[model samples]
Target: MDFLRHVKNILHTYWIGFVCLIYQVLWRPKELKDLQQHNGCVAIVTGGDGDIGMETVRALCRHGMHVIIGVKEETNGQSVEAAIKATCPFAKLDCLPLDLASFASIQKFVQQFKAKGLPLHVLVNNAGIMHAPFAPTASSSGSLESHLGINYLGHFVLTRLLLDMLKRSGTKERCARIVNVSSAVHAISTIDSIKEIQFSKFYCPYGAYGQSKLAVTLGTYELDRRLRDAEFPITVNCLHPGLADTNLFRHLSPVLQPVKNLCAWLGFMWTPSQGARTPVFLSLSEEVEHTSGKYFDNCQAVPSSPSSYDVRLQKELWNWSCEITQLPCDIQDEINIHYT
Candidate 1:
């Protein structure tokens, strides 16, 4: 049975990759434009120092938003801020140190942001590791596989910590936005049980990466449902930025690197600017002002993996995430009390 599951996963990964390649080759995704300026609005983008994340920050800054970049290293954050300011002298930006692998670091980052007394209009969970070597976070909450720890759980904790600020910043006319950068690879992942979600016995790098992305998608849907039910003025959405030619592929094996390079040469992969379109769209477009609980690609709402839509699975993951992250099991109650 395990062998069969592995075969299925491999097939799914290749099939999705093929389809994305064809789509990018056949049609160019449109750039986001003509959106009204976001003056006075504040946004946070995790991993804003990365290739795609840097482009995302640039786009938001170009729209006149005050963007706070969350970086693992303070120097990287400062560098990114300086680089953007060099071009757009009017760009309002700040750098905050954030290490998603550590719960303590995530908490500290939030406290520092709160100290500024700024309202968060958009939160982009953009940082992730793909096909990384097996390394677990030394978090006090509990050791988690690096992909799951930094990719999914860290963003989960960050979002929960800042929920109140998001609520206060949003209004009926325009809702606050949460943009989670998920991937089509999530379709290949399975999380039927808690044990599978936490730690797989035998880890395949691709499988681990896919599982973390699946977790992000599942949590996006579940949180959207909860926030909507509670009448919170925030919109939660996830997207698959088309497979871009980014540093994300640095971990690929030598055997796969040649194939990846060939794809980039053939124009099968997206540029960082192309990859940033959907995320930027979700963050600023009036078209999605009230859109929630949907997965997007190429700036359009599309269905995610069949498993991602499993309501029971979504709730289970949400509950377990709350337990592991030490958040209130009933987050709605916390939000409600804040509003009252």
Candidate 2:
């Protein structure tokens, strides 16, 4: 029975991979073009040094947007800067240090960004950790799991801190964008974990990762609602970049490494550039300019897991996040709408 279960799991994984490949072949994103609208626009991409993140930055730069690449270390940022300059000789790029695991670091990053008086037209919350050993972040609030703290809460706080800049851009362009990079694994999230997070012997790293990603979607929805209520033209959306061969799986146990390698050899994995298509589409695609609070896959709007749409869960997570981060829960009251 144990062997049979393992066989079933392997088959299911391959089946999903096969479907994603077919979908990509049939409905790939249109070739992105440079747009006059992106000239002098400022954007930030967290985890911009990673495979998919770097590709997203490259696409954004090719479109003429001035991009800030947020990396955890100065050296990584330097490397990214060098890479971008090699391809885009005239690209406007800045590499900044951002450590998402530490809230203090997040605050400092935001403050540094604001000190420059830069206008933020796009924010791509693309940095994340996956399936690592369970532990609290160095400065995580109240024993919050590291993955949740880094993957969701850190970006949550970063967005709030940069809200004014984003809102300001909306007034000028009639549209500013926030793109949260979630995952198809979000479908496995359980509301109970999000509402009352507790890790026990049954706790699985992948499960915690899913719950954190689900929070990302819920946060996107709640933020969209707040912006719309205030008549701000800022659009917030989330997406699942297809499974790709990347360093994200460095935490996989030794026993599973062979299986992962086999899958990669089978042509089932997406290249980083292919995985980036959906995020680039959501970030700058004109067709989606008026859209907000939507979940996307393969560069198209799609229904998220039903639980992701639950108002109760969304509110619960939002409030919980505010409480943990010590951000005021009444942010709606603080919004000063500049656009009618």
Candidate 3:
């Protein structure tokens, strides 16, 4: 049995490497040449303090966009600010407090952002927790699984609060973009009903993570559809950043952690920079300026799970998200009224 397990691990590692190699060979993203043109444009990146989120922030700053780094702690924000400045001295950056685990925090962050009177041109929903143990969000009052609350519900509220800003910032020259950093693991999720997602119910760490990621993708599709119907020049898309050795995997059991590390060392994983490629491309590349509601991998548009494209599921998820997040009735009506 032990030998069979070892062989299975070897096969898994090689398969990962094989897929990565194919993507690397086929999809090479080119850096936007006239990046300075984005100067003065504003971008807000959630969870931009470290990992792929930090790398995404770096790429945006280097292109001369004014970046707002959303972090839970001000000190972590300051550290990220200092780090970005060290390399891109011309980078215009601001670190603001944002906790994805709490709806109150998201509302407060939006208020503060609006007070700045800055137009929001890009939003990268890059903050997410993976394989978290059975727990509720910091508030816990809602009994929402931590991963679902933080990864999907938080971003849902954040985006709704800022929809006005994104709409106002759109133009033929620069259509506002929202890039959701999802994962390939979304394929594992088969969430059929809303009741199946409560934190008080049966929980599997990895399964919950997959469900949340799948929600991210569905949210992007619904947002895209609504924006198009409203004639709003905003694009929303999601992508699976190649497997990278980031801190999001810390929840792995001690027994499996070493195996994960071994896989990374054996060339099956990407560095944070490599993982940042698809997101940065989605955020900056002019090629996809009009692209919305699409799933991408390795910086290219690709088919996601068939379930992700189900229009009924998309609407169901959106409405449920609004209800769970406790969005105001009038606000929810206002947003939904635009849909056909």
Candidate 4:
């Protein structure tokens, strides 16, 4: 049975790769222009030192928005900030240390940002690990699987912490945005029980990564629903950044790494800048300014996996996330009262 599951997983991965190649051949990557500039608006992008995240930060900086990059290392954050400022001399940028694997670090990063008294206009949860070796985050409640912890839970806590600020910063005319960088592989993931989310005794690298991304997608939709129900002017959405040839593949075996690079060089994968396009578009495009709770690819709304839309699954994940994170079970109620 385990062998069958592994075979299925491999097939799914190859199928997605084949589909991405077709997408690259059939469509030209779109460019966004004349983005409306918000000189004082602040945006936070996690993993800003990475290929796609850095490009997203660069695009935002070019448009006059203040960008705060959340990095695991202070030096990496500073390096990215300096690189951007070199090109855009007036770019407003700050780097804060953020390690998503650690809840205390996430909370500290939020507190530090709050100290700056800046309003968050956009948040790009762009940090993720793919097919990494098995490891678990040492959490207060218990250990969390690394992929789920960093990719979904950490961002989950950070967003909840900043929800009030995003609410206050947004108005009817301009809603604050939350862009989660999910993946096409999420469609193949399943979360039928809490065990699937918290910890699985049997671990498969791609399986773990896919389940985490699926959680991200599920959380995106659930949070958007709650915000909209409360009439809050905040948009929550997630997207697939295409198969970009970024260091995300650094986990691959050394023998397979060159083959991956060769495929990328041969036009089978997107460059980091190309992967940044849809995220940048979602962040700044007037087209989706009010769009919420949708999944996107290549700058267009596309239906996500059928399971992703299951209200039961969405709420289950939301409730479980709150329980594990030690947040109030009825968080939306808290937000509503805080706004009132």
Candidate 5:
């Protein structure tokens, strides 16, 4: 009965929802003109290799912002930096080798940034992989789960590492927006262990991916609360990038490959450019500063399913993240981890 009622509610909102979805996908705006004069801003986009991340770097370069493009490997990462320099000669762009599955890489990347002594104007957690079978990383002691470890755990650690730089950015000009590129799939995800790391467990690839995204959204909510209490000047927000046709989906098991391709062909999954627009919006939009702790889809604030707003869920996820990352589980640590 409950499921039927839920389906009926979605149907009731179906037409208007479809209209909003179409407008968001079809005619969504870009920051082409407004991004200019972003001279001192240092923006970072993870997964800056082929699809949405690359497009985001393009937008930042055109706006004259210095961008740090983060990728998993030096070879694949450096290529994007070179491409940016070629097209946008005035655009200052560098590359960071970030393995979203590894903690050492994230720490090393942060150390390099701190060495520069420059304020980070923006941090975009844009890298993500989908539907991969179980695989753990060097830093992860968790069970054999790729999506949970990389998609969620990776950014949670990286964001915490970079929070000081972000605080510096907030003090300078715009209260920086830490944009976590989340997904609609989160609505389908739930954590099995919301307070501790689990290992060697049976895994569901898609469910794990969704769970990580749910963590991402929960992390954002937790961030909002922490920053508010700290009186921090920065804004933290999240969004579902919509399904984009990117290499990120190469993880689909062979059996599900056809269905994934079909979604792209049918326009259910978006193009890279389309998928990247909302991140760009959160990064540069004038209106978003006023709306924090919100998850956006199609450039508008929308409820992120009932689970996302559950404070208990957010805390449990946050605590679990801290334990997995082995970070200090202090109030300050929790606050810093969430907001940045």
Candidate 6:
């Protein structure tokens, strides 16, 4: 087997793999015949202006899915949209403003989307800020670091905002897919300093980045459980798009530039096109139709770090995330939620 594929065995305990394999035996991809009218199915992608996000746009377009590229700005996003249209002229695409760092922006975008009166089929929470300096935002949950605030908290709010739209899709098995983009570095992440999720005044760049990714992964598990209990139609899953050569690291310490360059030179890194394959495959794959609450890599289901599966931590991070977003979370006392 390819070394990259071997990573799957390393990720999941043997039992989880068996369960996934059995569930996938009857799996089916989303049917495209009905989505043609662009009435019931639409994909909303955050940070879709460039890099891996753009490649996802291309994939969705190729499959004839109407897509919305959510970005921090319209003009810049439009240029990317035009570029996408240049190749797939039939691509139904729109660019919307979405600053994940702002709670208001998150709410506003969802509200606008609802006004479109279209059922949202997939929400690819693809936007995130990485390795930036410590800064505070409404999504900070009293934390000084921007990594968790933007990467995890922002998507938290946005997903909450669109939950209704996701439910309305009403596919027979699952209504919609909420795919949160996480990272491979999650193997090194932990939420031990639970205090840091809030009042993160003391910051370590790597820790904060890892924590943010961990939070996204953990959130997927919690959301998956919640959906199951509520018997909701949506399926929640998260995946790591193996280190892509996107602009995500421009703000990292200058030394990282050389490190990134060296990694790419040595083939340890992937170009945005290569990195996008998993997310695109996850979004388009029929094999995963029955899969939920799992972390994936290279288009296949894999086990995330043990910390990511802890229900307690998942709950903690979910609460901390909601606190930061100041959004209402309907999690109940009866449900068991935690971080792995």
Candidate 5 lDDT over residue span 82-144, tens digit each: 777788878788886777777877887887777877778888998877766677766755453
Which of the predicted structures, 1 or 6, would earn the higher lDDT when compared with the native? 1
Output the number of the lDDT-best candidate: 1
Clashes of 4: 0
lDDT of 6 by residue, 181-232 (tens): 9986666565564674542234555556766888889889999998888877
Off by over 4 Å in 3: 1-36, 328-340
lDDT of each: 0.89, 0.81, 0.81, 0.87, 0.74, 0.72
Candidate 5 — which residues are off by over 4 angstroms? 1-36, 142-144, 191-201, 253-268, 330-340
Q: Candidate 5 or 6, higher TM-score?
A: 5
What candidate 4 gets wrong by more than 4 Å, as runs, is 140-142, 333-340
Per-residue lDDT, model 4, residue 7, is 66
Model 1, residue 172: C-alpha shift (Å):
0.6
**Tens-digit lDDT string for candidate 4 (1-340):** 6667666776797688778878887886777777788788899999999999999999999988999999998989888988888988999999999989888888888889999999999999999898898888765444788989999999998899888889899999999999999999998787777666754456777777888999999999999989988888899999999888898989887987887888888887889999999999999888998999999999999999988988999999999998778787564646221110
Off by over 4 Å in 6: 1-40, 138-144, 198-201, 331-340
Candidate 2 worst ten-residue window by lDDT: 331-340
lDDT of 6 at 289: 73
TM-score of each: 0.95, 0.89, 0.88, 0.95, 0.84, 0.82
Clashes counted in candidate 5 amount to: 1
Candidate 1, residue 187: lDDT: 90
Q: Please, what are the lDDT tens digits per residue for candidate 1 over residues 57-176?
A: 999999989999999998998889888889889999999999999878888889899999999999999999998888988664346889999999999989998998999999989999
Comparing 2 and 5 by TM-score, which wins?
Answer: 2
